[model samples]
Target: MSISERISALVGPASFVVAGGLSVAVAIFAAITIERRTIEDVETVLAADGIDWVLVSANGLQVFLDGTAPNEVARFRAQTGASAIIDPDRVINRLDVAAADTAAPPRFSLDLLRNGDGIQLIGLIPGPGGDEAFAIAEAIADIAGEAEVVNMIESAELAAPETWDAALAYGLRALETLPRSKVTVFADRVEVEAVGETREQRAEFIAQLQQDQPEGVEVVLDISAPRPVITPFTLRFVRDAEGGRFETCTADTAPARDRIVAAGLAAGATGVIPCTIGLGVPSPSWGEAVETALEALARLGQGTVTFSDADVTLIAAQGTAQVDFDTVVGELDADLPDVFSLQAILPEPETLASTGPARFTATFDAEDGARLRGRLPPGSIGQSVQTYASALFGADATDIATREVADLPQGWSVRVMAGLTALSELNDGQLVVEPDLLRLTGNTGDTELVSRLTRLLTEELGPGENYDLDVRYVEALDPVASQPTPEQCESRIRAIQEETKITFDPGSTEINDTAGEVLDAIAEVLPDCLHVRMEIGGHTDAQGGEGMNLNLSQRRADAVLNGLLARGVLVTNLTAQGYGESQPIASNDDEDGREQNRRIEFRLLASAEVAAAAGDIDDQPRTRGGILAQGEIADWPFEIRPLPRPINPDGE
Candidate 1:
């Protein structure tokens, strides 16, 4: 039981035991040495300043610090920081310091409130640095979740003035100065209310106020006041210069208006109103008044003078003085003798002084009575009077010539006729007048006879001086010849050789006629009928280009139609068409065949329906005797029956 015995028992097999113990001690030491070597091999990663250690439990590793780092980079370093000491089989990533909060700076709120309500902004914003503001707001909303922004900022200054009383005082002063209007002011805002009866005055007042105001005082204008519309007064006069009573019309009753103003002007007028002054004093005549005025005005070389509402006034400047008839007559004589007549009324000697100017009043009549009646040459007097009288009276003149002749010429008798016989006949059986005959009749009779005739006619008639004559015939003539009947148009269609030396052109239907006899004949016959529809049909020779030949034939037909039209035939009645070589009447291979094929022919269009019906009949043949027909029957050969079987030969 001693140490050695234990070591041996534990070492009695001591020699073997001692060797086993040494081996076991050596194995333990080697294990500790390997662990220490691994510890020394590990890197002491001292991170850059401001960095911290991160213990990661996930992989059992300690990570050192650095300035700033992303979360993912820090985490990876924590997992592998003590890589040399860690067992290869174990993971250590659980402990990592969260990355420093490197997010952007916090945003400011731009939420705006207006009138106790949130305002949503739309459209392009207007403000200084507005784009930057919008960008910031948008970024905040994106980062901190969507939040509405309401803009409450106002850029404009208030238009209201400081004190209401001050504004009212300003308005009162404005109104005082603009007496034509009422002025209203709210704050610095001004409005004009017009009291005048015109929009022009209201506009003028507002414009004046704007011009007088100084800067820095903000003004808003409300021009909503009712505007006064002023209409001008008018006056009209009718029938004032037609030898009728003077009439006046007034549009408005206001004495301050132009209608009344014009009337006032007339009352004090010094110039001529050119009013009518009647002749035959004591009992004036309208015709005489018109004539006298016109003559007097004409002699003065003045234009027509007329009285209007402005020329006559109810207001009296001189207390309604009576017109001085003598002075009016003298004035007419001096200024317008051609347009006026002056007649003096012979007053009884006892009443002469009392009559005043009434004894000689100016008269006026129509121009004919003044200048054309007795003033014309005596032979022309009757016609002149009649023409003017008819124009004035709108009636025909009667045969006062016989009644007015002082003495009839020997063997010269006057006769009167009426109705349509006075008119001559035209070729169309229409009646017309011979101008020379009418002129001769219109200038009828001797000079003295005409003068007497006119006076008598005018006395019989009323005041008018116009008339139509019933023609009286002194001689008779034979009746006119009758018109010829319209014969049916006829023209010779000559053999082609007769009219032209040249032959038809090759491949064409055009014929050349040196004499042009056929064309002349056609021209002579064409005018007889009311209308003639001529059909010119052309055929072409079968030499070349069927289409070209057909077209050429058509051109030839059209040439004929053009020729007829040029000769004055109506184009509506003519038609030209070509049939080409398809309608050849003779063989097309020979010259003679081609000549026949190239013929041009004419046909009267008897009726449009006949041509239409011919087109409706299809070229195909109808079945007969149950046989199927082919080819055009028009080209079928005629068959001659053989001589009757010779029964007579055996009998002979």
Candidate 2:
């Protein structure tokens, strides 16, 4: 029946005015009857449709719903049922739809791209203290120079992330490191696409971005710097008694450079950079030529290869086989790119009687007299060297044993003088010079000295001489190794780690600033413990899903490992392992217990030098087939240390 007809039967028609004519008893009875009928009809429809959570009411002909509905669909269903039984205009739905269950926040991100002309901010960023816009503008202004700013950013009013401040700070800070970059900033992830001015700068920037980012920020970096203009396209490297060095570095591309550097590293070259890939590259075949040339140089093992554009000079050391050198040089000459020409200058082997490359050797202690030995070319060149040495070592504190030699290589005097100058920078180290060879051995406290001198020597000695720096870093001497026993190493690590636990921000893998200090201390001691096998283990409490916790734990473990590597820990000695809720040490039912379980551990896996120093934990050696098994510890920095004899307490 229509609501009007039902009301008419119960009380009266809509046209009937009850203000003065209707009795109170009659109206009350009508309201009660209509309400009962409405409730019954609503319940019947709700049951048929499988919808619930709505209460029906009636005031005379008007019907009302007053209860919480599971959702909008349920509220609509109840209203539809009442409208069928009564006038549609008189049916009212007061049912409240239940609020939605909270879910994880979306990854908030935006990319701010700046170029030569102007700046364009793109992506979504949450308002942080309402200062994000200003921060972005200021950071861009600092780097944009005179370029105009274009704001294309859109923001939303959402809950701020716990690490938004840190993430924003880091992203803004990148503006200084990266002159031109497309920085994508998310609440948890920060990605950068940038260009560096030089290879060194590029590498340093990448290292800084990846290492020890604040807690709750995942860093993704792609930084590249083009190869600079190499005029004459010069190149030189030597391997001899003095050690090996590159007079200058050249690489047409990063991959080419990396391959070249890898070859050098394999051949024991340290602190060397390959050629950049920009201006003055003779041809696209530059990398190929470098690869073949480096192979040949590695084979020679003791010579200098200088390639200035097409002219390639191959100078062999004393015992280099003439036939082998000629064969390799011939192949290179024939196969080199059409734009390049090979000039193989193979000198006859040196005899003892022949005055070889001017020799310069200085042996001096800080407090005692010094001995300057070896030969220099004749005339003013020789005199200038003597004068420089005298001034450097002191006239009365020095004894000169060098003489003018015949037919020394051109600029031999300059190299000798430069060698002497470089030697003076060392506190107490030996510097030796030979034809195409310069070997430096000494101890210094300055870690920066190695890199500085590396570049300095390359510039002074012409980018084609062989140089070896055996300069030991003495930590006592502000600079920098002995292989300490594994026990001593592991104990030292644990001592620094015991008081502080490596914990991550809530649901984040980033290590906070405070935890980085502990990591720094760990890095300092890892050099001594290179012989020890260590595992960086991550664990979690059973709260979230098993898969999620496992993934989180794994990511956190990797983050810690990356952190240690950033702090200068040897990568070979460390392994990152994540054991999620599977290896919890405490109950997951309580917050404190869960916190205990959500921790990172630095555990000693195994070590060769076990008995040298007894640590708090008595770890027994696990041998396989009566020998040290090829396990995880033997991966890198491998060593077989003799177990030092244990001394009796009474000195027996």
Candidate 3:
């Protein structure tokens, strides 16, 4: 073979080999590029969909996803999201879903706070029953009409424990009864905190809760009733021929009570005289003031001492030597605390009247009520006398048919008021007020009445003033026999009204003459119920303008009060309020309902409110015998004060 021919053959073969090698290199480069692009695309898709937990890798056209996903849902989501950027067949899911966590169930509890502002519920409740968790809130809203319900509760998708329902129910019941309270409920326990208006109410609340406590659940109840506030704290002490006693005594603290009681005992007060320890002392020197007053009374030998907050009143017995009264009163006035003002009275002997020494008399019995047949100075004083007597006894229980005498003594009103006040201490009593003397004969359930009466008379009349007491202590004549509970008094009044309505003239406040008998019956009941404070509510149909109806109701209520006053009922503790159509028990849509709506009702005042009102009434200063001076007792210097000096023990 020639060289050219060999070269030609070699070239053809070599070319074929080179060309094949080039083709192989290109294919290898293209495969590497395709793998890189595929991996980049898969990663971009997974990253865009927040599937970072999934690790992405691709071999040629096949994509693999691997990583621990938080949950099956998350894993599935990542797979679906990644597949959207590529063919589903090309995507391989090697991602492992995290093992299902063994989580503990959530603890559940509920707290309920109820007050004047309404009810609030907070805490977690077992669920899917979200609506059921609000059942308590809904129930309170329904019962308390327009009461706000604040719900900050969350419900878990879990079943409530078996004990949860019972505990919750019990807590809800407690909440319903306790207006001012907090109730916490758990599966195994219920805690209730409440405040009551009085100790009795607190006891009732505890008893009710304990009685109705749920079985198999622990219950914790905390109910509190605070001490009542005393206004114009009163202390009355007397030492006479019968020895000494307290009619009413109040102290600010236990130590103060002890001090006051000891001083009273030292001054001749006998028996276990109870001194009320309560709030509201005019000054920290209350004990000192009382002690000084008692000392003065002791020095005077026979007298009464009264403390109305910072004011002190001392009355010397009429027979006390002028020098003795002057010395004691002057010393007491000077020695008393600065906060106290003293009024020392030395009564003058009364002149005899042609008509039995210008007498005033009051008689009381449980069955027949009270009768006031007395001579009062002609004027509004007569009306005042009736009103005063009624306040102490009860309007319905008293009858006043007194003739006004023109010439009653100067201190006659004081004597009358003092006698009536003392008589009220007895269950059944008769008091006679003469110009120069006061005589009381009564049966009392209170063993301490005679002593108290003796003290009151001495204080109001004068130390050593002529007064006689034939009062007897009889269990049957206890005040409880005459004085009914507030509820019972209201019930008795209701029964009387139910039997015969207290009718008035059509569209007028004038009570019909026929209602006189009803008024009289109510008056009889009032005397026995004098201690109870009450409201006489007047209501009218919604036929007239709102303002007119209100005015009409007020007038009617006032008329009723005036009628009771005329019947000799005490109106001090009784108040008249006109509601108009504001608080109607029956509908005004029909005649019968309207008639029912236009009726009078008797309601009991809360004990606290009654105390407040009573205090206001009793706060008025009673300058009976005479007001020796006002302001600081020490200001009245002995040199200037007009008190008689004694000539000698034998010579006046």
Candidate 4:
């Protein structure tokens, strides 16, 4: 303020007088310069540049460029031209260009996929006028959850059709009906892919989708429903001090599965759940079989029934009474349909044997109602075993078939006592053990006994112990083993052959129809004799040359073997040989004697295990009764007859 006031006072009147004089002088000079420049080039420059839109005027030392230029460039040129005629700094230019007259092309598309989790959207769409696109996206985000939305749509410049809103609403409604689906929407068409849990659901989804399609729009739909697959239908249940529990459970149908679960509940099994339903079941009876098996298993109190299709395995708890085990196994075997196969295991003392070198044995008879023959350690240990068996089997029934032994491994007494206790539980079966392993074989329907004993042994014996289980759990032991191991098998076969000779056709190897039927009896015994081998030897009278007779005898023997095989006999242990006329049982001089000499005989051969089970017969070589032999045939199971005289080749 001070500086400005001082300067104003100093130059106020003098500056006014000097400015007026200078203005007059400048004005006079500018008028003269304008007059000369205007006349020289201003009008001539406008005509030469064709710049009619521009006008120029002079005012002393400043130049004014007026009028509208055609464009910015024209305006700039006008300014430069005026500046060229006068001073550059004194010129000013003004201009305005026209507004643009075009807009961009259109793009529109949208896709949506929805599942149990949520929904996703993708592709282009017309931009909603006034932020409607944002509002729509926000609405979808709210419905499907923001995390699930995938908005990849690009709005088109063209306005959306009047029906676009209606189509979007229809598609979304259709999507609601199909949680698992993918939907695509075009201006006039809706395409969908969907899944349903069952046929009805799939049908309903498709119907709803088609009905909701926008008016005058095409609807494309793909829907499917499929059942699940269970790799191996499996089930395992057991009971112990902790009660019952299931390792795994599965079923093919609802009803059977329900029954299995119900049985488990009845037995107090924990963690029950519905079995998965599928089409991969072995048969319609699959459910019933499993359910019935479970019930049987439950009745036994402890056991595991593992079923994969029709192959069923039952493992009974140790010490299960032999009668009960046999009854159950036999009953199940008879009751179960032909489609199923049953295998039962009863593990006893060996189940709890010491890992080191040792020997032990135990016996039980549910039928005789007692525990019998067994081997135990000496002194207090042996007394303890005897005492334990007496308690479990009752003193009267406990016929202790035992002897004292020394050098038993540690824990031998405990294992022996445990073994006896386990034996007491069986109906009837004996167990033997050595440094190698222990084995239990008996009959019982009781599942609980096996399950309990199995658990007990696994816990006490350690995992390394071995078991050679021969226990069977059916209504009966073995029908074949039960009826006649000696008579019905080998003895019966020989009896048939003796009562009725199996004759052949002259010198031919063919057996007579009557002979074939007799051989069928021998076939029946072959399987039971899995323990032994049978030899069918053929003989011939001295009517022909030795070579021919020998050949004939061999052929007849071969015929017998083949006939046995044809009748379903397992001939694995059978052989055929020809003695020809060499080993004659009767004089070859007479027809009657010759006929007797030309006969077929059955002989027994014993394998190692069979020899052990067969007693004295293993050491003795024996031939069928009334035939040539080194020793008499033991009263074993096989039975066969001599072949009658064959009709002459000339058809006598």
Task: Find the candidate with the highest TM-score and give its number.
Answer: 2
lDDT of 3 at 174: 75
Where is model 1 more than 4 Å wrong at Cα? Answer: 1-423, 426-487, 490-504, 507-517, 586-590, 607-652
* C-alpha lDDT values of all predictions: 0.34, 0.67, 0.74, 0.63
Better of 3 and 4 by lDDT: 3
The better-scoring model by lDDT among 1 and 4 is: 4
lDDT at 114 for candidate 3?
Answer: 90
Task: Give the per-residue lDDT of model 4 (tens digit) for 342-448.
Answer: 88766554444435445566666665765445456889868877887788878887676677778766666665565555566667888776554556677765533
Model 2, range 70-183, lDDT digits (tens) per residue? 778777878887777677998877888899777766667777776667778777667645445554565456546578878777666676577765566556546445667888
Each model's RMSD to truth, in Å? 38.7, 22.0, 25.3, 33.4
Per-candidate TM-scores read: 0.23, 0.45, 0.41, 0.26
Find the number of clashing residue pairs for candidate 1. Answer: 48
Better model by lDDT: candidate 1 vs candidate 2: 2
RMSD of 1: 38.7
Residue-wise lDDT of candidate 1 within 1-652, one digit each (tens)? 7888676565457687798999999988886675554433433332322224542222123322232334676656544555535654453334434557755322221221112122232222222445333432432232222334443332212222234323332333343334333344443344544443344455544554453242333444433334221111112121212222112112222222333224323333222232211112121122233334434333332122221111211111112123443454466545432333333221123344433321101111222121111111234433454454344323332212212232222211110111012111101111111211111122211212222222232233211212123222112221111211111331333333245422354544444564244555565555553233445666677787756666676677777767667777666645676555656678987888877777666544322112322332232112110010110111101110111111111221
Among these predictions, the greatest lDDT belongs to: 3
lDDT of 3: 0.74
Q: Which residue window of length 10 is worst by lDDT in model 1?
A: 625-634
lDDT of 1: 0.34
